[model samples]
Target chain A: MTTFQPLDIVRTSATVTTAPPAGRDVEVAKLIDVSKCIGCKACQSACLEWNDLREPVGTNLGVYDNPHDLTPNTWTLMRFTEWENPQSGNLEWLIRKDGCMHCEDPGCLKACPAPGAIVQYANCIVDFQHDACIGCGYCEKGCPFNIPRVSRIDNKAYKCSLCSDRLAIGQQPACAKACPTHAIMFGTKTEMLAQAEKNIGVLKTRGYSKAGLYNPPGVSGTHVMYVLHHADQPQLYAGLADNPSISPLVEAWKGIGKYAGMAVIGATALIGAFHYLVRGPNKVSAHDEDEAKRLAEAPK
Target chain B: MNDKAPSGAPVRVPRYSGSARINHWIMAIAFVILLLSGLSLFHPALFFLSGIFGGGAMVRWLHPWAGVVFALGFLMLFIRFLPANLPELTDFKWLAKIRYVVSGRDEFLPEVGKYNAGQKLVFWSQAALVPIMVVSGFALWTPGLDFLQSTFGIKATMDHRRLAAVVHAAAAVTTIVIWIVHVYAAIWVRGTLSAMIRGSVTGGWGWRHHRRWLKREVADGHVKSG
Candidate 1:
C-alpha cells in the first residue's frame, strides 16, 4: 500500500558551480588594556632598539606626545589622547601604542606599484623590504590609517616592519619585552586572541562596562589586535572608522586589460608607419599642416 | 619610407624635430634615473640602488629635479601634440570602446584620427599631473612659502603645506600606476618599442592594424625625414 503524503516534493538536481573559497585560519595579534597602560614609553624604546631605528629626527610641536606620532624613522609610537567630558565631569588621558597591525589585508600591500615592496608574512605581519620599495607612494594611498610614512630622503616608503628580524629568531617582539607593565602583549595569534578575550571579560566584570575588544575582521584581519578601554560604548567607539578593507586582486586582474589596450594602440601606431613605408616620405603628421607648409616655404 | 626613392633622392620630413627629440630623451633619461633611485629609496633593501643617481642622498636631491624634468617633457609634448590631442567629437566614440580596445579582440574598436582613446587618456593625465606636481612640490619643499607676519613677528596662519603634500603624494601615486600600464602595454604589444624608436613599421602590420591611419598616410603623402 502506498502511503499518502499531504505534500509531495518534486525531484530536483543540484547546481555545482566553481568559485574561489574563503581563506583558512591564520594567526593575528591582540593588544593592551588602555587603562592598564601607564603612559610608559617602554614599548616605544623596545621597538626602536629592536629595529635599530634612529633617534627622533624632529621634536614635537606642542602635543604632550613627544617625538609626535610615528614617522619613517620612528616605527612604534605611544599616542596620547586626552578627553574631557562635560557631562561625566571626568578628565581622562589615554596612551595607545600604535604601529603596523601587520594586517591580513594590508592597504600598503594593495597600493604598492612595485611588487614585493610591502608584503604579508606568515602571521599576517605587514612586512617591508627596503631594496624592493620603489617609493612611488602608492602604499600611502592604500592605507586607511595612513601609517607608512615616506621619507623625503629616498622617496622609499617606511613603516613598522613588525620586527620581522626578531620574529625570525622566535623571540618576543621588542616592545613587549620592554613593557614594564606587560601592557603590550605579543604571542602567537591564537594565544594572544584568547588572552585578549579573557582580559576584556575581566574588565567588564570589574565595573568597567565599556571595556571591549577592537579586532574588526575586514582589514585582512590584523596581526595586532586591541582590547580597547571603551570598545563597548558607541560614544567612545564611534570615532573608529568602519569597514577597513583592501582590494584583493588589483593589477592581478588587470593583466587582461593591459594586453587588450596594447593590441589596439600598437596596431594604430604601426598602421601610421606602414602608410609612410608604401607611399614614400614627406607625409604631414596627423596634425600640423601649417608647420609643414612653413617649412616648405622657408629658404633652405 | 622616403619621398626621393627610385627616380628621386630620399626626402626627409621632420616627424620629431631635434629639439623635440632632445627634450624627450632628456625626460626619458631623467625618469629612468629617478625611477631607479626612487625605487631603491622606497625600501631599505634596495637602498643600495642609490647608485642610479649616486646614493641615498643623491636620490633624495635628484627625485624632485627629475620630477621637474618629467614635467618639462610634457611641456614639449604639449607644444607638439596639443593640436592633434585636442578633444574632438570623435574622441567620445573612441573612448566608448575603451573596454574593447583593452580586450584585444575588437578589431573594429574605434577609428581615431591621431591619438586614440588609451593614448589620449595617458597623455591627458600626464598633462594635468605635470602642473599639479610642480605646484604641490613647491608647497612641500621646506621654506616653501613666506609666512605673513603679524605685528610682533607672529606668523599668521601658515598655508596648507600638508594639503599640498597630500596632493603631491596623490599625483605621484597616480603617475606610478599609469607608468606601470604604459610600460606593460609597450612590452605586451609586439614591435611597439621599435616603431617609436626607429620611426618605422611593416606594411601589412599597418593595414590590418591601423587601417584608417595607414590609408591616410599612403594615399595622402610620403614619409620623409626632416
Candidate 2:
C-alpha cells in the first residue's frame, strides 16, 4: 500500500489563491514509442488490475477494441487505426495506448468548479480526488482531450492518476512495467526526451522520414509524450490531435469570464444601493391621497 | 383580503388575484433556489452553498428539477402579464424620461399603467433568458436520457457541449443581474410589495405613480372610497 505524503501540489482546481511554490521537484514523464507497439493489450490489463477496476463485460462493436471507449471503469485503452499509404500501396496498423496526457497547463484543473477535486503534482502527475468532486462534468467541457469521465453510480469524476501511488513508492507505473516491447518507458522528462530522440533516429534510418515526437506545445507540452513513425500526420494514428490545446472557449469561460461576471454583479448591486441612498424611496404623499379621496367621493 | 374593498371601507382595488399572487411567490421562491444552486456549481468559492441542497450530488440532481419548476412558473407569468407588459406609445415616452423616474421626480414622466417601462423590461428580459437557461441547461445535463441529445440536435460532440456550456453560464449571469435589479426596484418603490403580497395597492399609490391607470379604473366604476 502506498502511504500518503504531503504531495507537492503544483496546481489545484477552483482555487483563487495561488498554491505555495514549496514543492519544486524534478518533473517526470512517460514516453510511448508508437512504432514499437504491437497492438498488445497488456498495458490495458495491467492498468485495470493495478487500479482494481472491474469494467463490466461489454459487447463487440464491430471493432477489435473492447469497451468501445474510455469509461469510468476503463481508464486506459488501446486504440487501433488501420491506414494505407497511397504511395507505398501498403497498409499500416497504428496502435496507440490512449489515456490522460497529464498536460502541464491542464484544462480540467482550470475548469473544475470544485476546489481540490483535481490536482497536479510537482512531478507532472494530474490526479482526481473523488471526495472533493461535484460530478458536474465542467471538467469535460474544459478538457480539450475529453479525458475525464463522471460515474453515475458514485457521482464523482474519474480519470487516470498516472499511478501516482506507485510513483510515490519508487515503483514504475503498471502500464509501463507491463509493456512487453518496452514501448512505454518512464523516467525523468529529460531522460525520456533523450530516449525519444534516439528512437526517432532509429526510425529515420529505417526510412521513416516523417518520424518525430508528439509532444504538442499547445498545452505547453504534455508529460505523456509519444514517439511516432508518422508523427507528421498524427491524425492518421487514431485521430491524435495534430495541435491540441485548451479550447479558447474554455479559457474565456474560466479566465476573464469568472472575474467579469463577479464584477458586473457586484457593480450592479452597488449602483442600486447608491441610488437608494441618494434618492429615498418613491413614497405616496398625503396630497396624492387627498386627491384620490376627492376623486372617489365625487359621483356622476 | 376576502372581498374587494367592501362598502364604507378604505378604497382598495384588486391588482393580483389569489392565484396570481401564489404563482408569483412560487416563481420567486424557485428563482432564488435555482440561483443559489446554480451559482454553487458555477465557482468553487461558492461551493459551500451546495450544503443547502444536501451535498454536491444532491445539488447536481435537484438543479434541473428546480429549473423545471422555475420555467413552468415563469411561463404562466409570461402568459398572465404579457398583455399588460406589451410596449405601447406611452412606454416609449416613459423610457425617454427614465432620468426623472430614477430620480424620484415622476411628475415630469408620462402617466403609466399596470406595468411601467422598467417593469416591462424586466418581464421581457426574463422572457428571453429563461428559455435560454432552460434549453442550454438541458444540453449540459447528461443524465441517462440519451433521447434528449437528439431532441436539441446536439450531436453529443465536445464542441457542441462546450458551446452550450459557455452560453448557459453567460445567460445565467445575465439573468441574475436582472433579477437583482427587479428585486431592488420593488424594494425601492414603496407600496409595490403590497401589490404582489396582499394583491392590492393603496389608491394613493395608484394616483401618485399610475394616474392614467387609476383614472381608467375610476371611469370604469371600479373604485370605492371611505
Candidate 3:
C-alpha cells in the first residue's frame, strides 16, 4: 500500500485545501471493454484477493450474480444482463463490471461532512479514510451511481478505491492485471480514450454500430470509462444511469443550503443581541407590585 | 396567594410545578447537546466543536441519542404546557401589539395568560419542528437503517436518506433559531427565568406580565402557602 502525500490530494472533504500540488501527477483511468469481457469473475476474485476481502457466499437468487448486490466486503462484482436484441432476434448476455466509476468530480467527496474523510487525489482517485469517517452515509446519498456501502460492523463506508495504492507503486489495478482477454485496460486517461476509440472502430466494422465510450460528462466524465457495445442504451446492461449526476438535493444540502443556513442562524443571534442592547430587559414597575399586593389581599 | 420571604419581603406566586421545571430542563439540556453536536457536523468551521464529544465519530453516535432524549423530554414538556400555551383571543391582541412587546412597552399590550403570543409561537413551532427533526434524523441514522433492514426488512433507499438529510438540516436550523428566540425572550423578560428555576415568580412579575394568569390563579385559590 502506498502512503499518499498531503500534496497529492486535490480535494479534501469539509476542508479549504485548494492549493494544487506543485508537480501534477499523470491522470490515470481504468477502461473496461464490455465487448471483450467473457462474463468471467476473474477480476472479481483478483479484487477480493488483492483487497483481502472475504464476502460470505450468498444463495443464488435465480441469477448468475454471486453474492447478489455489492456489499462493503465486495468492492467489485460482474453484473450479468440478458438482453434479447429486438432487430437481431438473438439473446445477448451482456456482462458489465459494477463498481465505483470514480468520477472526476466525485459526489462522495462533495457530500462528506467529516474533514479529510473523503479525498480526491490529483490522479482523480477518490479514496476514503476509514478513521475519519463518521458513518453518516452522506456519501451514499451524494453518489449518483449508488456505489458506496457502509459496513454494519464498524460503521465506516467502503467502495472501490481505483487501486490508488497499486497506482502509486506503478502497478495497474488488480482487476486489470488479472483480465485474461485484456478486456480491462489501465493506463493514462488519454491512452484509454484512444484505446476506446480504436476498439469502437473495430466494433463498428464488426456490425456493432452503436458501440461507443461511457465516460459520462454529467460528473465531468469518470476515471473509470467503459467501451460499451450499446453506449446509447447503457441502462440495458443492468440499470446503469443514462445521465448520472449528483442529485440536486445533495447539491443543495452541501452547497447553497449550507452557507444560507449559517447566515440565517447568525442573523438570528445577531438580531437577539441587537434587541437586547436596544430595548433592554422589561422590568416590573413599583405600581404593579402595589396592585399585586392589593389584589392578593382583596381578591376572592 | 404568595410565599412570603424569610425576612418579610415581597411575596412570590407559583408558576410551575417541580416536575414541570425538571421536564423543561431535561429538554433544554438535550436541545443544547443536540445543537452543539449538530452544528459540529453542519459545517467545517464548527468541526472543532466535535472535540467536546470526543471526536467526529462520537458526535455522530451521541447526536441522534441526544435527539431521542430531547424528543421524549419535549413530549413531556409539550403535554404539561399545552393547555397553558393554547391560543387565546387575547393572544391575537398581544401579537398585534408585538412592536410594543419588543420595545418593552408592555403597558400598551393586552393582558396575557401564562404564555404570551411570542411564547405560544415558540411552543407550537417547536412542537411542529421536533417531530420532523426526529423522524428525518432517524432516516439519516445508519445504525437505525441497518437495524430496520436486518430486523424488519424495511429498507430506506438512498433517495429517502438524502431527502431526510435535507429536511433534518432545515428543521434543525429552524429549531435552533426558535430556541435562540425562546432563550432571548426568557432573558429579556426580567424575573421570567425564576418561573423555571425556582418554580415561581415574584407576585409583581406575575401581575405585570401575565396579569390574567395571576388573577385566575388567585381566584382559583391555587397560590402557594408561605
True contacts kept of each: 0.00, 0.60, 0.64
Candidate 1 lDDT at A170 equals: 72
Best by DockQ: 3
Task: Tally clashes: model 1.
Answer: 33
Q: What ranking of all candidate models by TM-score puts the best one first?
A: 3, 2, 1
Clashing pairs in 2: none
User: What lDDT tens digits, residue by residue, belong to model 1 across residues B106-183?
Assistant: 355555554566767788898888788777765544322222122234332212443454455556556666666666
Worst 10-residue lDDT window, candidate 2 chain A = A1-10
Give the alpha carbon lDDT tens digit for every residue of B154-202 in model 3. Answer: 7888888899889999999999899999899889988899999999887
All candidates' lDDT scores?
0.58, 0.85, 0.88
lDDT of 1 by residue, A149-200 (tens): 7776766778876665676567667877788887788877788878888888
Candidate 3 — which pairs collide? none
Question: Can you rank all candidates by DockQ, best first?
Answer: 3, 2, 1
**Candidate 2, B-chain TM:** 0.91
Better of 1 and 3 by DockQ: 3
| Least accurate 10 contiguous residues by lDDT in model 3 chain A | A291-300
Task: Tell me how far the alpha carbon of residue A17 in candidate 1 is from the true structure, in angstroms, after superposition.
Answer: 25
